[model samples]
Target chain A: MDPSQVEIPPLKDLTIENITENVHLINSRCPNPRLKYLMKSLVKHVHDFARETRLSTDEWMAAIQFLTQVGQICTDVRQEFILLSDVIGLSLLVDSIDHPKPASSTEGTVLGPFHTHDAMTESNGGTLSHDPDGEPCLVICTVKDTSGKPIPGAKIDIWETDSKGFYDVQYAGRQEPDGRAVMQSDDEGNFWFNAIVPVPYPIPHDGPIGKLLKLLKRHPYRPSHMHFMFDKPGYDHLITALYLRGDPYETSDAVFGVKESLIVDLKTVTPKQAKEYGVAEGCRLLTYDFVLVSDEEARSLREKEAMTAMEKLGLRMKLLDGLPVPDVD
Target chain B: MDPSQVEIPPLKDLTIENITENVHLINSRCPNPRLKYLMKSLVKHVHDFARETRLSTDEWMAAIQFLTQVGQICTDVRQEFILLSDVIGLSLLVDSIDHPKPASSTEGTVLGPFHTHDAMTESNGGTLSHDPDGEPCLVICTVKDTSGKPIPGAKIDIWETDSKGFYDVQYAGRQEPDGRAVMQSDDEGNFWFNAIVPVPYPIPHDGPIGKLLKLLKRHPYRPSHMHFMFDKPGYDHLITALYLRGDPYETSDAVFGVKESLIVDLKTVTPKQAKEYGVAEGCRLLTYDFVLVSDEEARSLREKEAMTAMEKLGLRMKLLDGLPVPDVD
Candidate 1:
């Protein structure tokens, strides 16, 4: 197509009211219908946010600069954008919509910025924490289905902070992975790990997000929680964390990742039991059950929940719904 | 405030339906009312977008990584996020809202990604283009109030692409400015400069945003144009661009920056006339007039435009309106 053959919007017609429409007009040509809709919805929401806030030019530039800084600081070990999404609750919201279960099946939560993939693999009853400073915790979990069937050969990736409240990756010149490991569920669907009792710790606030939270007079802290990610063939992967029930930040997690079903108490275990559990003194026990959802069930549930979510949000979506939803999967 | 004393949303109640509310509840503690409102609105729209799209986990992660790459690619010169905003028409929408003018005054366009503060200052009728490969263009403009009275000593910063459609800054060499210069309007509000007739050019496409445009089957080319930024004390600073009328990308600018009023035709100047303007052979003359708005007038107009914009966007605002508009200014 000859570019000049396109209809041009006259300057007089490019008023603040119609500018977004004109933008959509140009974007309407996108060949991929799903991308077209995504762009349309994304642009509409973003523009609405700007107009609703009457976002000043300076503020917009500041946002651009802030986002740039967030991106620039990210590395293989660090993802500032994830931290941004976490602090703003976008991560948890996505987790809820994309991978969530309720009732007998366990629900999901934010994967968080501290998760890593290079964890050491171990069999059942593995040790995940190397930090001796933290109180020893024996974590026991059963991988099961909603019908009470054991999910054998399931892989569980878990990580947590030491007493110092820092991930091994957070340290300069990190050596081997510490406070993190992957373990497989036994034939009977049981997986246990001798680990440290994760404690409440502040999210890195020394970065731009920290500065933003500081400006808002908001603290940057996630409640004490050990991260867990479960995966198995034919079952929907679960990305979640178990919060320490009595952690100070439990109710006010900076990332909003806490949930009642996901919070568990840390029971103190005697030295003898700790020895039996193969953990050091000052021991505790963390226990929970993860009921995995099948992929088909998760798909149906996701579709059903999406329908309910439209009305639940109470956000204006009639216009967006009017647009065709391509195969988003 | 003690976090434990705070109310916690029970996991049963923390269904997908009420997660947003819980987030808002947590964010409600933000002492800065403006920041609180901003966060509230921002999170609402973001969550709405996610739910409306039923955005997949993989897609969401892709966006996260995309945004991160955009930020990391930015340097003192490059700003991928700004380009992202520009292509999405957020920049134009913000420009229309932030510093726009209507019938009597000059309407603003995007400042674009090429603008820099290090232009070499020149006198009236000075030359701005040093690239010998481009056809010369003589640019003349007068700065005046809406009443058409001359506003003397106004500063005009102008930049444009060379014949090859590359900004001086885009060159690999770390050299002096080539096609950019600052000029002072004369006592009679007349400012003239010799420059190259800019050609249509593609925005930097090797970055994440470029990849996105490619995925959407959208081209990255912006129309040929000259950037002009005018500033004077007590007057609202104007950032705008004048597009070449017949450029192939005129009607289909990638950034949606082409406006009818800002488009000007370039007339060829005779050899002798080119010398009179101190421009190279095969010269083209570009002419336009800029009408400035004083700070008082601009603020009033901004307020007026903002009110109309709320109605024009046709986005759901009733719910957003229920929230108190803290002193944003």
Candidate 2:
């Protein structure tokens, strides 16, 4: 302990462990125990990642720049960084571990980067596709409980792309919500609608996330599909999409939303059956059944839905209660 | 399974559960298993947090806004968000769990948000405080092994504030790296320098971190302290700071960098002792000793330092071997 025995300090020997240890010391001195623990844990992991990788200065700066671009790309309509999470699979992993669904229900998928709050409601069997130039098609679906009983008065919120593979929102000027509709089923748990067969398309690629994917040598296409969110009381809510069979990107969906159970056959209908469904002869007709799980599964689904919504919107705890709800449009 | 028993789709009952479950299903279809797992997990946590708090649309947007601001505020020199992490203690927590330093050497603390690479090197007994306008004092320190033997030829990198409590970096024009020095210990593990004692001061408050603290109703002051990073061949590197005794903000240091063992007293020197050390009579002197652990500890310290340097410089693995080191200003 003699003052004469003090050694001078060295600079180059700086390491992650020392940096983190210093950070921990600060954490231990914080006034709030919870904040302290939280900060300490975060610093430790971040530093560890840096140390394990032997991260270089340029790489660190690049990361900082990537983060900066992620912020800049965020706007009211586009959340490319969140989409980055979708592509990276961080979002889905969180969803699965937190929302363990029952075996009887359909699996959930990502709420892709492009979900808006404004779709016009329509009567049962109403057409979501307003464009006459698109290929004519009919969609018939059955809603039932896990035990095979029909669920009366179920609702189907549906959306799809035009034949050109563009959503109404994507071509705001050209389309008037052409492929978006909300319809309620009748007493027989059946729902039918007329629409155009959606085509496969590429996600917007002008942003940083797109650039990153390109850098990674990945494609940016999603298979043709119809988005659906089905709901009935006492049954698990289902947010799902039906992908068309034989789509090229089925296996390499840019956002990774494809499932074997979700692929459906679009059958060429006869003129007689077409007349009955109010569609022209040779039009494609697609039919599928959506089975809802029990009450417990339904609850989990609800929890998962809430979590997904929050994450997409990037809602933090402090702003949860008093912030105004964003306009769905 | 009869077609006649199928129920129609319903619209009104589409609860949050359906939305979440649907999202989960799509997530499971990702091509890369790792990406799928990560996305699911992130989505689940985000959604759960949202649902648990009932976050509204506005609240969500506000969060997005906050994150955006966090990104916007980051730059080459100022990293307010990182400071936020430091204050919140995430950085430290991560450090501790990653590098469990043995209890022999000085415990680590946070590397304050502001540090420059170009510190002036000084010979033995060289004073860092060129403008000695504050509490005039002599700093005497020693480095020793666990057995209390001197560690010969150790290096000590030291930095602190002037009597007015301002680092050289804080005032661009006024200081020439004053109050910062790199020196080597003699054969006896002893190092001494004459300087002015630093006073407590406020961290910069013009940036986003300052704005956030203000929003949270918190102060922005750190206790007076001298920074030290000591290293020897056979022992662990020591990254530490010495807090001034009786500082008003010791308990509430903005970045929480106070440690009980690191605090030291500034004693007034007698006329006789001042002459012996060839200093002015009635000057003040602060003395402390640094003890280093074995080689393992030193290796950990070195690792942490390298990691931090890499993080600061933004280096990556691909560039490490052939990359040229940046010129330190």
lDDT, candidate 2, A54-105, per-residue tens: 4333354455567677766666556765677555544444344333456665
What is the per-residue lDDT of model 1 for residues B181-232, given as tens digits with 9 covering 90 to 100? 9989899999898888888889988888888877666678888888989899
lDDT of each: 0.80, 0.63
Best by lDDT: 1
User: Which 10 consecutive residues of model 1 chain A have the lowest summed lDDT?
Assistant: A315-324
Each candidate: RMSD to true structure? 4.1, 12.9
For candidate 2, write residues B108-132 as lDDT tens digits. 6666656556677787667778774
Question: Alpha-carbon interface RMSD of model 1?
Answer: 3.8
TM-score of each: 0.91, 0.56
Error of 1 at B221 (Å): 1.1
What is the C-alpha DockQ of each candidate?
0.44, 0.07
Runs of candidate 1 exceeding 4 Å displacement: A1-13, A270-276, A279-282, A310-329, B1-13, B270-276, B279-282, B308-329
Worst 10 residues of 2 chain B by lDDT: B6-15
Per-model fnat list: 0.46, 0.07
